[model samples]
Structures are given as structure tokens and as C-alpha cells.
Target: MRKLAVIVALTATVFLASSCRAETVCPAIAQASVVALTVAPEYVSSVKSIHLKACQDGRCMGADLDLVPGSTPIDQGCEPGSYGGDGVCSATSSPDGTLTGMLMLESLTASLIEVTVTGTGAAGQPLPVRALAFTPRVAYPYGEQCGSFITAGVVLDANGLRQAA
Candidate 1:
């Protein structure tokens, strides 16, 4: 009886210790925001193409943007399509020129990920702008009882540049 008890206690201790050190994999969240803007040429009119420079961390295998109401994730190789409607803006200028629009991001799970704009500049002049950081909540599976968390923000020049950012 005594030997059996000792064996059980040892097994329990080892089990508890191992379980405490077990690795837990949590979903990763990467996000960025627009802090400031700088317009050059002074007289540059009609919005063309907007460029947002962003930095990201973690394994973002793929990414997609929710530009239109029912727009789906298209191939990264193709040029980013237009938002609003078909006949909205006809000029080919900087899209980020205006700072009023929706920017949606989708990525795989990560432990800790964040994105931010490093800097903004024209052809040769660097502009002064602030960095925006955001932490997105995990999106739960559908019909699984848990509610899904959606992170929505303005699509800045940084996001339009890279995949992670």
C-alpha cells in the first residue's frame, strides 16, 4: 500500500509540472493607423493614388482588404481596384490624399503582431507624420457561441504598400 501511494504521488507531481510548462498558442493581431498627412506641390489637385507605408511583425501568410461593400479578396499581383462606385474618381492620382475611408484587414492567427507607418515623403522630401497602432480582437468561428470581433479603420497609405503592414 505504501509503495503504491508513493508512486501515485510522484506521477501526479510530474503531470502537474509538465502541464504548467505546456506551450499555449494564441492568435496574433497586427494593426496600423493613420496619424498625420502632408500634401506637396501645394497645387496638386484631383486625388490619384494614395500610398501608405506600413511595418508589420509575425507570420502574415496572406492579406485582404474590404474596400467595397461586397468586395472579395483579389490576387495581390493585380492593382488595387477602386472603391465607392465605377464612375466616382477618374483621375490616376494618390488615393491616400484624402484621409476619409474605410480600411479592412484580414490575416491568420498570431501571438503578438503590430503595424505602424514609419514615415511619409514626396519624391525626395520626407514629411512629418505620427504613427498609429491598433490591437485587433480575435474573430471566433461562426455558430460557435462566441461572438466575432471585427476591426475596422481608415485605410491609410501604409496598408496599401505591403502585405503585413
Candidate 2:
């Protein structure tokens, strides 16, 4: 009787443990189409390359834009990185060409701005982009805190350029 009770208890514990296991679902990552990046007149001359990325719930998607070592800035650039990887920009558009979401970028010292392109082809297709501007805001001194650092409101895309429904 004692052995049977122990076995039953172990079985129940195993069943409960298995049932209590939590499931983690990763969010879907989509590629972003960069249409244009315009820097302020003051930054236009000093700007080199602008790294862009899309984010949902604080996850950065696409390639990191490094705008330091280059000659002649590019007006239009492709999505920085590949999908499901760090330093990449994800798409905020639905299956169709409509943009109901936005791609975000991490704040750096440089000023930048992203614009969404829409319509059809080179003249009309919809393209949404998040622009980051290099401004004299609060700077994090070298090494300070031990948490995620986020600088919001650096890029203004208030026109619903990249909003996904």
C-alpha cells in the first residue's frame, strides 16, 4: 500500500508540473521598405549614414544604420538588416500596401527623420520610415545604470506613415 501511494503521488506531481508549463510565442518579424531619410539643414552636410529599424513592444528589427564613414549620403536606402536578426528594421504594413504601423529607431547623438512612402511605383507606392534626429538631449555618461536605455520621441512620424492595422 505504501509503494502504491508513493507512485500515485509521483504521477500526480509529474502531471501537474507538465500542465503548469508556460508557452512562449515569439512575435512575427517583417521586412521594412525604406523610402526616404531627410536630415535637418544643419545636419544635412555632416550626416553620413542613417541606420533604421522597426520595433514592436520594444524589439528592434532590421540592420543598424552606421552614418559615420561614408562619402555622399544616400537619399533612399533599403531595409538595413535581415529578418529575425538584431539591427534590422521590420515592416509595419498589413498584407496589402497600406501602412497601419511604424518602424522605430534607437536614439543616438545624431538627428534624423523617417518618412513613409505610399501610392504605387517610384512615384506612388507606399513607403513609411521613422526618422531619428541628432539633438542635444540628455546624454548617458559612458557607464551608468544596468537596465535597457530607451530615448523616445527622437523621431516624429505623426502622419501615420507606418501604422499597421
Candidate 3:
């Protein structure tokens, strides 16, 4: 009975520790899509994205959105695309298309992600992006196939977290 009690206690302790580990703990590396959306030509003026990766200790490598590519041909008149078919939806983080910038992961939770942008353009201004919070996460409902490159089907703030305006 003594041995059984000890085993049960040990198991309980392990279980508790595991449960505690489930709490939010920053990872060694992570990625977030900080996109400004609803852009014309590519996206339906409703999709955007952002990206970042942990590079070194206390430092990270950031990425800017490739917005210039948005000049690509786009069909303004959208239609219901096949969910499984290889539709025209596309996205790019090149330094020219869409509104994107460097991504800095400050912290993250199951429902919330804190990040900042340091590249690309926000409202035509070469402004540095502040660490924005993805409360409940930013998701776009109006998604098209061909616009992924420009729309990227991603997001940051619902109001388009751009710099100038």
C-alpha cells in the first residue's frame, strides 16, 4: 500500500507538471503573417500578410512584403472558386508586392500573438511597424484564388495597420 501510494503521487506530480507546461511559453522560433489587405488588382481589397523568424539570441531576421508584383494581371470581377481546385489564388512577400514588412515576434498565446513590422510599406510610407497584437487572430473572409500573392489570404489588424494612412 505504501509503494502504491508513492507511485500514484509521482504520477499525479508528473501529470501536473505536464499540464503546467501547456501554458504559453515563447518558442525558440516562430512565424507570423503581418499582411495589410483588401488590396486592388490582386486581392479583393481585403487580404494582407506579415512574416518573421527567430534568427539569433535576442535578435531576429525579418521579411518585407513583395508589393510591386501586385502589378500582375488581376481579375477584379471575382467568382466562387473551387475549394479543392488549383485556383489562381497566390501571394508573395517580395519587397515589392502587397503591404508587408519585417516581423518581430514579441510573444504569443493560444489566442493572441504579439508582433511588429520593420520592412515594406504601410500606406505608401516607409514607416516602421509597431508590435501589433493579433487578438483572436486576424483572418479575412473574402478570399480569392488569384489574390493570394497580393492578398496572401493573411492579415494583421482588421483596420489595415499601415503607417501613413
Candidate 4:
């Protein structure tokens, strides 16, 4: 009888140990440090090219941004006279007359960043230089377990260079 009790206790412990285990599953994705820039339509029309200089943690990197036409997705709010209220949902791509570029950085270990932006006018004249000093924001977009990434955004508009919200 004592042997049978010992066997049952061992089985119960094994079952409980197996049931108590939890698995952690994470998404498969990659992330990098990048600075994204945007030029307002009003400003984009006047500039032919953009040159960017960025410094962080005593390291400096420079690049001429390959600005591309920017677009936004618009939700028209469903289709008319369709099955269910979901019919009113529709999306359209609209060009906002903006130009955008992304600049990859080695790292954003420092809190402070110094940036210089120079533009060439459509007529081949040099536009005024804009400089800004600001702190970048860090995020764990895929959750903390997936690691962290840093990003900075600047917009050039009629008001000149400014941090993006």
C-alpha cells in the first residue's frame, strides 16, 4: 500500500510540473535605428535636394536624402448601399504633396542630437541652412521583450526645420 501511494504522489508531481510550465512566444521581426524626415508640400515645391548632417554620442553621420513623393491613406468611411455597415468602409491613397526620406543611424545612445539641413532651390540656388538640437524618442514597438528602437523625425515646412510630433 505504501508503494502504491509513493507511485501516485510521483505521478501527481510530474503532472503538476508539466502543467505549470509556460511558453513565451515572440513575433519574428527586425528593427533598426532610423531618422525619418518630411518636407511639407509648400516647402517641397521649392527645394530640389536635401543634405542632412546628424551627430549623436560624439559620432557624426551625413547623407543626401533621396526624397520621394509621399502619400497618405484616406478612409472614406465605408461604401454606400452595401451589405452591413462595413460597406461604408473604403480606403484611397492621396498624395499630400509632401516629400519624405529615412536616414539609418548606427545607434541613438545619446539623448541629444544635432542636425543640419541644407536645401537646394529648384532654380539651383542654395536655400538657407536650418539647424536643430533636440532629443530623440525611443520605443519598443513590438514590446519590451522584442528589444527597443530609437527614432527621430524632423519636418521642413514654411516655418523651417522643426521636430515632428
| Candidate 3 runs further than 4 Å off | 1-61, 68-109, 120-126, 136-165
Best by TM-score: 4
- The TM-score, computed over Cα atoms with residue i paired to residue i, of candidate 4 is 0.72
Q: Which regions of candidate 2 deviate over 4 angstroms?
A: 31-41, 45-165
TM-score ranking, high to low:
4, 1, 3, 2
Count clashing pairs, candidate 1: 15
Candidate 3, residues 77-109, lDDT tens digits: the string is 434568964556555333324443333334322
RMSD of 2: 16.4
Relative to the true structure, candidate 1 has a C-alpha RMSD (angstroms) of 15.4
lDDT of 2 by residue, 1-165 (tens): 999999999999999999998764433433232312323333333333344443333334554343222123333434545664455434442232111222344432223333222222223433344433232223333323422223323221324222211
Question: In model 1, which runs have C-alpha deviations exceeding 4 angstroms?
Answer: 1-50, 53-112, 118-125, 138-147, 152-165
Q: Is candidate 1 or candidate 2 better by lDDT?
A: 1
RMSD of each: 15.4, 16.4, 13.6, 5.3
User: How high is each candidate's TM-score?
Assistant: 0.27, 0.23, 0.26, 0.72
Question: How many steric overlaps does candidate 3 have?
Answer: 29
**Candidate 3: C-alpha RMSD after superposition:** 13.6
Superior candidate under TM-score, 2 versus 4: 4
